[model samples]
Target: MRDPILEGALRRVRDEKARDRGRRGRLRAATSAALAAAVLAGGLHLGRHSLPAHRILVATTGSTRMTTTITPADGWVRLHAAVDGIDPGERCTLVVTDSHGRRYVAGGWVAARREHTDLDGAALVDPADLATISVVTVDGRTLVTTTA
Candidate 1:
Protein backbone atom coordinates (compact mmCIF):
# COMPACT_ATOMS: atom_id res chain seq x y z
CA MET A 1 0.00 0.00 0.00
CA ARG A 2 2.46 2.66 -1.17
CA ASP A 3 1.26 5.11 -3.86
CA PRO A 4 2.67 8.45 -2.71
CA ILE A 5 3.82 9.32 -6.23
CA LEU A 6 0.36 8.84 -7.86
CA GLU A 7 -1.43 10.67 -5.04
CA GLY A 8 0.90 13.65 -5.35
CA ALA A 9 0.22 13.89 -9.08
CA LEU A 10 -3.56 13.79 -8.54
CA ARG A 11 -3.32 16.49 -5.86
CA ARG A 12 -1.29 18.70 -8.19
CA VAL A 13 -3.93 18.37 -10.95
CA ARG A 14 -6.78 19.26 -8.63
CA ASP A 15 -4.92 22.28 -7.22
CA GLU A 16 -4.21 23.56 -10.76
CA LYS A 17 -7.87 23.29 -11.71
CA ALA A 18 -8.97 25.26 -8.65
CA ARG A 19 -6.37 27.96 -9.28
CA ASP A 20 -7.49 28.28 -12.91
CA ARG A 21 -11.11 28.72 -11.84
CA GLY A 22 -10.10 31.52 -9.46
CA ARG A 23 -8.22 33.29 -12.25
CA ARG A 24 -11.18 32.99 -14.63
CA GLY A 25 -13.14 35.48 -12.55
CA ARG A 26 -10.90 38.28 -13.81
CA LEU A 27 -11.45 37.22 -17.45
CA ARG A 28 -15.25 37.13 -16.99
CA ALA A 29 -15.24 40.57 -15.38
CA ALA A 30 -13.28 41.97 -18.30
CA THR A 31 -15.73 40.43 -20.78
CA SER A 32 -18.71 42.03 -19.08
CA ALA A 33 -16.97 45.41 -18.99
CA ALA A 34 -16.24 45.19 -22.71
CA LEU A 35 -19.88 44.40 -23.45
CA ALA A 36 -21.04 47.38 -21.43
CA ALA A 37 -18.60 49.63 -23.28
CA ALA A 38 -19.93 48.43 -26.64
CA VAL A 39 -23.53 49.00 -25.66
CA LEU A 40 -22.72 52.55 -24.53
CA ALA A 41 -20.75 53.31 -27.73
CA GLY A 42 -23.49 51.90 -30.02
CA GLY A 43 -26.33 53.72 -28.17
CA LEU A 44 -28.26 50.39 -27.82
CA HIS A 45 -30.84 51.19 -30.45
CA LEU A 46 -34.27 49.54 -30.05
CA GLY A 47 -37.53 49.50 -31.98
CA ARG A 48 -40.33 51.96 -31.29
CA HIS A 49 -42.44 49.27 -29.63
CA SER A 50 -42.23 45.64 -28.60
CA LEU A 51 -44.86 42.99 -28.03
CA PRO A 52 -45.51 42.10 -24.39
CA ALA A 53 -45.34 38.40 -23.69
CA HIS A 54 -48.16 37.06 -21.58
CA ARG A 55 -47.39 35.64 -18.14
CA ILE A 56 -49.53 32.76 -16.90
CA LEU A 57 -49.25 30.28 -14.06
CA VAL A 58 -49.71 26.63 -14.95
CA ALA A 59 -51.23 24.28 -12.34
CA THR A 60 -51.72 20.61 -12.94
CA THR A 61 -52.93 17.58 -11.03
CA GLY A 62 -50.49 16.03 -8.50
CA SER A 63 -48.52 19.24 -7.99
CA THR A 64 -49.21 22.66 -6.50
CA ARG A 65 -47.49 24.44 -9.47
CA MET A 66 -44.66 25.04 -11.93
CA THR A 67 -43.97 27.91 -14.34
CA THR A 68 -42.69 28.46 -17.83
CA THR A 69 -40.16 31.19 -18.47
CA ILE A 70 -41.22 34.31 -20.37
CA THR A 71 -42.13 32.83 -23.73
CA PRO A 72 -44.48 33.35 -26.64
CA ALA A 73 -47.88 32.81 -25.00
CA ASP A 74 -49.35 31.86 -28.37
CA GLY A 75 -51.24 28.72 -27.43
CA TRP A 76 -53.64 27.08 -25.03
CA VAL A 77 -52.96 26.31 -21.36
CA ARG A 78 -52.47 22.59 -20.77
CA LEU A 79 -53.22 20.30 -17.81
CA HIS A 80 -51.63 16.96 -17.07
CA ALA A 81 -52.60 13.86 -15.08
CA ALA A 82 -51.40 10.41 -14.15
CA VAL A 83 -52.11 7.40 -16.35
CA ASP A 84 -52.32 4.71 -13.67
CA GLY A 85 -55.04 6.56 -11.75
CA ILE A 86 -57.19 7.46 -14.76
CA ASP A 87 -60.17 5.27 -15.60
CA PRO A 88 -60.40 3.76 -19.06
CA GLY A 89 -63.89 5.08 -19.86
CA GLU A 90 -63.89 8.34 -17.90
CA ARG A 91 -63.56 11.57 -19.90
CA CYS A 92 -62.66 15.19 -19.12
CA THR A 93 -62.62 18.41 -21.11
CA LEU A 94 -60.77 21.75 -20.91
CA VAL A 95 -62.72 24.81 -21.94
CA VAL A 96 -61.09 28.24 -21.96
CA THR A 97 -63.10 31.37 -22.71
CA ASP A 98 -61.90 34.94 -22.51
CA SER A 99 -63.77 37.91 -21.01
CA HIS A 100 -64.58 39.04 -24.54
CA GLY A 101 -66.84 36.11 -25.41
CA ARG A 102 -64.09 34.10 -27.13
CA ARG A 103 -64.00 30.38 -26.35
CA TYR A 104 -61.38 27.66 -26.70
CA VAL A 105 -62.38 24.02 -26.45
CA ALA A 106 -59.95 21.27 -25.46
CA GLY A 107 -62.24 18.29 -25.10
CA GLY A 108 -60.77 14.83 -24.35
CA TRP A 109 -57.32 16.24 -23.47
CA VAL A 110 -57.22 14.30 -20.19
CA ALA A 111 -56.64 11.00 -21.98
CA ALA A 112 -53.69 12.34 -23.95
CA ARG A 113 -52.15 13.99 -20.90
CA ARG A 114 -52.47 10.78 -18.89
CA GLU A 115 -50.74 8.94 -21.70
CA HIS A 116 -47.85 11.39 -21.76
CA THR A 117 -47.45 12.39 -18.09
CA ASP A 118 -44.10 10.64 -17.98
CA LEU A 119 -42.92 13.10 -20.65
CA ASP A 120 -44.26 16.16 -18.68
CA GLY A 121 -46.74 17.27 -21.31
CA ALA A 122 -49.17 20.21 -20.91
CA ALA A 123 -52.65 20.75 -22.31
CA LEU A 124 -52.28 24.29 -23.57
CA VAL A 125 -55.04 26.87 -23.32
CA ASP A 126 -56.09 28.62 -26.49
CA PRO A 127 -54.25 31.87 -27.19
CA ALA A 128 -57.57 33.67 -27.38
CA ASP A 129 -58.25 32.66 -23.80
CA LEU A 130 -54.96 34.25 -22.80
CA ALA A 131 -56.98 36.95 -21.07
CA THR A 132 -57.99 34.65 -18.19
CA ILE A 133 -55.90 32.36 -16.01
CA SER A 134 -58.23 31.36 -13.20
CA VAL A 135 -60.84 28.75 -12.39
CA VAL A 136 -64.62 28.90 -12.82
CA THR A 137 -66.90 25.99 -12.02
CA VAL A 138 -70.22 25.28 -13.70
CA ASP A 139 -72.71 22.44 -13.31
CA GLY A 140 -70.32 20.35 -11.20
CA ARG A 141 -67.36 20.91 -13.58
CA THR A 142 -64.37 23.17 -12.96
CA LEU A 143 -63.05 25.38 -15.76
CA VAL A 144 -59.55 26.88 -15.94
CA THR A 145 -58.77 30.29 -17.36
CA THR A 146 -56.54 33.33 -17.13
CA THR A 147 -57.22 36.17 -14.68
CA ALA A 148 -55.98 39.56 -13.55
Candidate 2:
Protein backbone atom coordinates (compact mmCIF):
# COMPACT_ATOMS: atom_id res chain seq x y z
CA MET A 1 0.00 0.00 0.00
CA ARG A 2 1.25 3.48 -0.93
CA ASP A 3 1.18 6.30 1.61
CA PRO A 4 -0.86 9.30 0.28
CA ILE A 5 1.74 11.79 1.42
CA LEU A 6 4.58 10.00 -0.39
CA GLU A 7 2.50 9.70 -3.60
CA GLY A 8 1.74 13.41 -3.54
CA ALA A 9 5.41 14.29 -3.12
CA LEU A 10 6.36 12.05 -6.06
CA ARG A 11 3.76 13.73 -8.28
CA ARG A 12 5.13 17.14 -7.42
CA VAL A 13 8.67 16.06 -8.33
CA ARG A 14 7.55 14.75 -11.72
CA ASP A 15 5.65 17.99 -12.44
CA GLU A 16 8.66 20.05 -11.54
CA LYS A 17 10.89 17.99 -13.83
CA ALA A 18 8.49 18.48 -16.74
CA ARG A 19 8.38 22.21 -16.20
CA ASP A 20 12.22 22.39 -16.10
CA ARG A 21 12.52 20.49 -19.39
CA GLY A 22 10.12 22.95 -21.04
CA ARG A 23 12.11 25.88 -19.79
CA ARG A 24 15.36 24.39 -21.08
CA GLY A 25 13.88 23.78 -24.53
CA ARG A 26 12.65 27.36 -24.73
CA LEU A 27 16.02 28.63 -23.68
CA ARG A 28 17.76 26.59 -26.32
CA ALA A 29 15.48 27.95 -29.07
CA ALA A 30 15.99 31.51 -27.91
CA THR A 31 19.74 31.11 -27.88
CA SER A 32 19.74 29.70 -31.40
CA ALA A 33 17.62 32.61 -32.67
CA ALA A 34 19.93 35.13 -31.06
CA LEU A 35 22.94 33.50 -32.67
CA ALA A 36 21.30 33.58 -36.09
CA ALA A 37 20.46 37.24 -35.71
CA ALA A 38 24.01 38.06 -34.77
CA VAL A 39 25.38 36.28 -37.80
CA LEU A 40 23.02 38.14 -40.12
CA ALA A 41 23.97 41.48 -38.60
CA GLY A 42 27.65 40.74 -39.01
CA GLY A 43 27.18 39.85 -42.65
CA LEU A 44 25.32 43.07 -43.35
CA HIS A 45 28.00 45.13 -41.68
CA LEU A 46 30.74 43.53 -43.73
CA GLY A 47 28.83 43.91 -46.96
CA ARG A 48 28.25 47.58 -46.34
CA HIS A 49 31.82 48.41 -45.41
CA SER A 50 33.83 46.06 -47.63
CA LEU A 51 32.59 47.41 -50.93
CA PRO A 52 35.43 48.44 -53.26
CA ALA A 53 35.88 52.05 -54.33
CA HIS A 54 35.05 52.92 -57.93
CA ARG A 55 35.78 55.78 -60.36
CA ILE A 56 35.03 56.13 -64.04
CA LEU A 57 37.05 58.02 -66.63
CA VAL A 58 36.25 58.62 -70.27
CA ALA A 59 38.63 59.77 -72.99
CA THR A 60 38.50 60.11 -76.74
CA THR A 61 41.16 60.76 -79.34
CA GLY A 62 40.13 61.45 -82.95
CA SER A 63 38.21 58.23 -83.63
CA THR A 64 38.78 55.86 -80.70
CA ARG A 65 36.94 56.25 -77.41
CA MET A 66 37.86 54.62 -74.13
CA THR A 67 35.99 54.38 -70.85
CA THR A 68 37.76 53.02 -67.80
CA THR A 69 36.57 52.08 -64.36
CA ILE A 70 39.15 52.23 -61.63
CA THR A 71 38.95 50.32 -58.35
CA PRO A 72 41.46 50.86 -55.58
CA ALA A 73 42.72 47.96 -53.48
CA ASP A 74 45.32 47.51 -50.76
CA GLY A 75 48.43 48.26 -52.82
CA TRP A 76 47.08 48.09 -56.32
CA VAL A 77 44.41 49.42 -58.61
CA ARG A 78 42.09 47.42 -60.84
CA LEU A 79 41.09 48.72 -64.26
CA HIS A 80 38.20 47.81 -66.46
CA ALA A 81 38.45 49.30 -69.94
CA ALA A 82 35.84 49.52 -72.64
CA VAL A 83 37.14 50.66 -75.99
CA ASP A 84 35.51 51.36 -79.32
CA GLY A 85 36.55 52.37 -82.84
CA ILE A 86 39.83 50.46 -82.85
CA ASP A 87 40.62 48.51 -85.98
CA PRO A 88 40.42 44.72 -86.02
CA GLY A 89 43.61 42.79 -85.18
CA GLU A 90 45.20 45.89 -83.64
CA ARG A 91 47.28 45.14 -80.58
CA CYS A 92 46.61 47.60 -77.77
CA THR A 93 48.17 48.17 -74.37
CA LEU A 94 46.64 49.60 -71.23
CA VAL A 95 49.07 51.75 -69.28
CA VAL A 96 48.85 53.49 -65.94
CA THR A 97 51.09 56.33 -64.84
CA ASP A 98 51.74 57.36 -61.27
CA SER A 99 52.43 60.83 -59.95
CA HIS A 100 56.18 60.10 -59.86
CA GLY A 101 56.24 59.46 -63.66
CA ARG A 102 56.46 55.70 -63.20
CA ARG A 103 54.57 53.74 -65.84
CA TYR A 104 52.90 50.39 -65.36
CA VAL A 105 51.45 48.20 -68.04
CA ALA A 106 48.13 46.91 -66.84
CA GLY A 107 47.22 44.66 -69.77
CA GLY A 108 47.11 44.14 -73.54
CA TRP A 109 44.77 42.61 -76.05
CA VAL A 110 44.02 42.34 -79.73
CA ALA A 111 41.04 44.21 -80.96
CA ALA A 112 38.27 42.05 -82.47
CA ARG A 113 36.52 44.66 -84.65
CA ARG A 114 33.45 44.61 -82.42
CA GLU A 115 31.48 47.63 -81.33
CA HIS A 116 33.16 47.46 -77.94
CA THR A 117 36.30 45.75 -76.72
CA ASP A 118 36.25 45.23 -72.99
CA LEU A 119 39.19 44.08 -70.88
CA ASP A 120 40.47 44.11 -67.30
CA GLY A 121 43.89 44.90 -65.88
CA ALA A 122 45.70 45.84 -62.67
CA ALA A 123 48.60 48.06 -61.71
CA LEU A 124 50.83 47.85 -58.64
CA VAL A 125 50.24 51.52 -57.84
CA ASP A 126 47.85 53.01 -55.34
CA PRO A 127 44.79 54.68 -56.78
CA ALA A 128 45.60 57.91 -55.01
CA ASP A 129 48.93 58.05 -56.82
CA LEU A 130 47.50 57.42 -60.22
CA ALA A 131 47.96 60.40 -62.54
CA THR A 132 47.00 59.21 -66.02
CA ILE A 133 45.60 56.26 -67.95
CA SER A 134 46.45 55.64 -71.55
CA VAL A 135 45.70 53.19 -74.35
CA VAL A 136 48.61 52.83 -76.71
CA THR A 137 49.82 50.77 -79.64
CA VAL A 138 52.90 48.54 -79.61
CA ASP A 139 54.87 51.23 -81.46
CA GLY A 140 54.23 53.88 -78.72
CA ARG A 141 51.34 55.57 -80.44
CA THR A 142 48.72 56.69 -77.94
CA LEU A 143 45.13 55.97 -78.86
CA VAL A 144 43.65 57.84 -75.95
CA THR A 145 44.73 59.29 -72.61
CA THR A 146 42.83 60.63 -69.61
CA THR A 147 43.63 62.06 -66.20
CA ALA A 148 42.90 59.83 -63.25
- Report lDDT (CA) for all predictions: 0.44, 0.93
- In terms of TM-score, which candidate is strongest? 2
TM-score of 1: 0.31
RMSD values for the candidates in order, in angstroms, are 16.1, 4.2
Query: Which candidate has the highest lDDT of all?
Result: 2
User: Could you estimate the TM-score for every candidate?
Assistant: 0.31, 0.65
Please give, for residues 27-123, the per-residue lDDT of candidate 1 as tens digits: 9999999999988766644332233464445544342222322233345444332223233333543444555766554334333332332212333
How many Å off is the CA of 79 in candidate 1? 9.7
- Evaluate residue 30 in candidate 2 and report its C-alpha lDDT on the 0 to 100 scale: 100
Stretches > 4 Å off in candidate 1:
1-49, 59-89, 110-129, 133-140, 143-148
Tell how far residue 30 is off in model 2, in angstroms. Answer: 23
